[model samples]
Target: MTHIRPTAAPATRLALAGAVALLAAACTSTDSGGAKGTSTEAKGAVPAVSAPPSIATAADKALPIDPYLLSYEQRDQLERADSVLVTRCMARFGIQYQAPPQIPGGNRPRSRTDRRYLEMTADSAQAYGYHGAEGDRPTPAPPPPQVSDATRLVLTGSAAANAKSGQGGQDYNGAKVPKGGCLGEAKEKLGANPSNNGGGDAQLARDIDAGARERSKTDDRVLGVFKSWSDCMRTKGYDYPDPVKVLDDPRWSSPAPTDVERGTAVADVACKQQANVVGVWFAVEAAYESQLIEQNTTALAQIRKENEDRLRAAAQALSS
Candidate 1:
């Protein structure tokens, strides 16, 4: 098994598109679950949406993973060896590889059986050519853009929302309202808050506050996700191979591109092995974000505006 480095994906265009996507989605969803009685805040107006309580109290809400960490080091390593690093990475993430499973109980098969099993699996992979690991061999390029069927599977497969909804399909766990298009009924009927001044449900408020603090610590978690993916690849022998040294490696522009891409890629490889894990990760983040934004839309809006500028710069940097 050989390691392949991943190319850096261009960041600016990617960020710009994401920002625009969020903005566009916000404007269109009438049921964004904002102040229902009040007239929706005019988009250009100081967005009337209230900031979450956590954002105003000098508490930090954890940001999601940035996703642009890899620099094509993994892809280069695998490509040069004429092995399918992506497939191997996918295998680490849990895609079915034709290789024999580690059977316990010393169920050692006869040599003939083992060879027959290996040959069958190898033929299946060769026929499919996931992520073009086999395509690098002397074959005409299957298609331009060269995205593999596995990659596509990772993309269109269960999105991040499916697993987050608990008993009810609409909510992220009935803890907060769905921010995006998520909707479902609740499993447990929620109770009303008790009065304060030694009269209210102090425990409930404390629980909510604690969750806010935990969710705010997103940077480390996001980094861990990247490290986890990289480590998984390494375990499968895609050990961060340097793309620069690999002959004719594609010029990727960023580590993982962005949080969305990183999540999608993780889902692609991981979900194949562990379905709904990606959706769960996304749903947790989304639900936390909803709570945080409910208290601090102003700050988030400001960051979002700056994000547009940063994305433009990133795109320009990549283009240059």
Candidate 2:
């Protein structure tokens, strides 16, 4: 699957990885056409459950696409397993390497949609304002272990990492560097390396899922909600085109939330409630995702299977 980073605003950036693909070796299997689901939803026809009731926020509601997606935990596990594989490959070249930390030292794991959408709760808006975090930030992870010029080439499999790194040629310590270096070899083992024409048809499902999100932004239903939200905000002296505009407001950039930021956030949540912005927006996206899922059930099934395969392999790699 293709792993596109979330396009959410910084404040909305949390634990969700959306449709992150798995790392695997059998992803290169041929496409078997598309899969089918029981959903026979006709064109322009949204499924039942148009929208959640008032007070039912995204935090408690999983979208139609959630079942077909990789949770943040699954993505993290696959990545750590990939790192372990890479570390082993590095050992073959006589280089000591440490895998980078995947999860934070102390924090609850975030869900796929914990903060996928904008914060719509009155409490959160009032507490942290546009800054989703509270208290001092966690210490940043340490820098990656430094390697020698020759080691860099073996690690990255990139001749362009530096001039001296490449001059050592493919043969280092009498062992040839894998086609793409250790990283490349690790991906090759998982069959998830796209550059080499690897990967399964599950990418089709991922593309559709990501496409729904991008297209939803311009959807007329969502656009209508944006206007209502904007008008409601104006009544409170917060003149902004839409909620997204506030994400870029230069006034919110600081070490902490200022009084002005808190006030704006409080008003923002109020406007959202007044306009039912979250309710409408969530339903629209759900409809789009539902249609896509119904249209591509076969491919989605393959993705789910491939992910399970990756987890098993990753678990084995971690144990070894």
Candidate 3:
């Protein structure tokens, strides 16, 4: 994964959009739990809706592997730390860099898995349909400020370089662009191994996050719940064989949610609760992650430590 370097700013907050974008983007954009580009605070206000019908809501909470990875807030800290370092580095070359502002909590998902299985609760479904959860959607990002070629070179080592790359060292303005450019240098300083892009363990944590979810889809236990949930959907008059099929339906494939789409989405959540699809599926994947953790305790322990240490450094960097 060659990343786009962040001279512009660190990770902008992301939110999920409504049916129009999600009808097209959900399948692809949801892999990593809904990362996005603009601020988490959307331009408009969210209308209130009735609380979702109560059931086993544990799946809406954290999973076993969650403790090993960075929280949304910690991720925010990493972004702040990266931006701070890059801003400091750019100052040396007389380029003005504005670090991204700190993101307040509750504006972002508490966990990346908050919508992983997409068993969106009824409250959210009633409000946004299949678009996304309460605060889901990638807010549209503004155009990045334009910079000259020389500034670009210093900001990012290559034309498409990201802060995670450690190569592309060069000299400019009587000073060397630290082993990587300012962005990459920032990455290296913040504990990510720019050479490998994730310090090795971080990527593994990501693998665990995505891999376990993908693996759970095929697990027999999940398949069983899918059947139960599917049966429940049929009773509601929807003929979907499974929840996945509902998401893949051509009917909901529109920019705007139809009365039909919202109705179907509501029924989807109702069926999910009636069948406890999210609870069963979440438990199954959590068990899978537990096995993975047992198998990779050494690496996971290291990842946990690195995350804590990195956050500490990030906090110090920001406070200073």
* Candidate lDDT values, in order: 0.27, 0.61, 0.60
Q: Scored by Cα lDDT, where does model 2 land? A: 0.61
Instruction: Sort the candidates on lDDT, descending order.
Output: 2, 3, 1
lDDT of 3 by residue, 25-73 (tens): 3111111222222111112222222332344455357777888776666
lDDT per residue for candidate 2 within 85-107, as digits (tens), equals: 88898899888887676644222
Error of 3 at 189 (Å): 0.7
Would you list the rank order by TM-score, best first? 3, 2, 1
Candidate 3: residue pairs that collide: 4-162, 5-161, 5-162, 15-136, 15-137, 15-138, 16-136, 16-137, 17-137, 20-255
Better of 2 and 3 by lDDT: 2
Candidate 1 lDDT over 1-320, as tens digits, reads 12222222232222222222332232111211232321111222122222222211111222221111111222222122212222333344344433122111111112211211011122322332122122222212222233344333332232343343223212222333322111111001011112111111222222232343244223343234445545554554443322111112232233323433333333335312222222223334435534534544443343344334433433442343
Residue 19 of model 2, lDDT score: 17
> For model 3, what is the error of residue 222's alpha carbon versus the real structure, in angstroms, after optimal superposition?
1.8
- Where model 2 places Cα greater than 4 Å from the true spot, the runs are 1-51, 103-109, 134-141, 158-160, 163-176, 195-202, 254-256
Best-performing candidate as measured by lDDT: 2
Worst 10 residues of 2 by lDDT: 16-25
lDDT of 1 at 42: 25
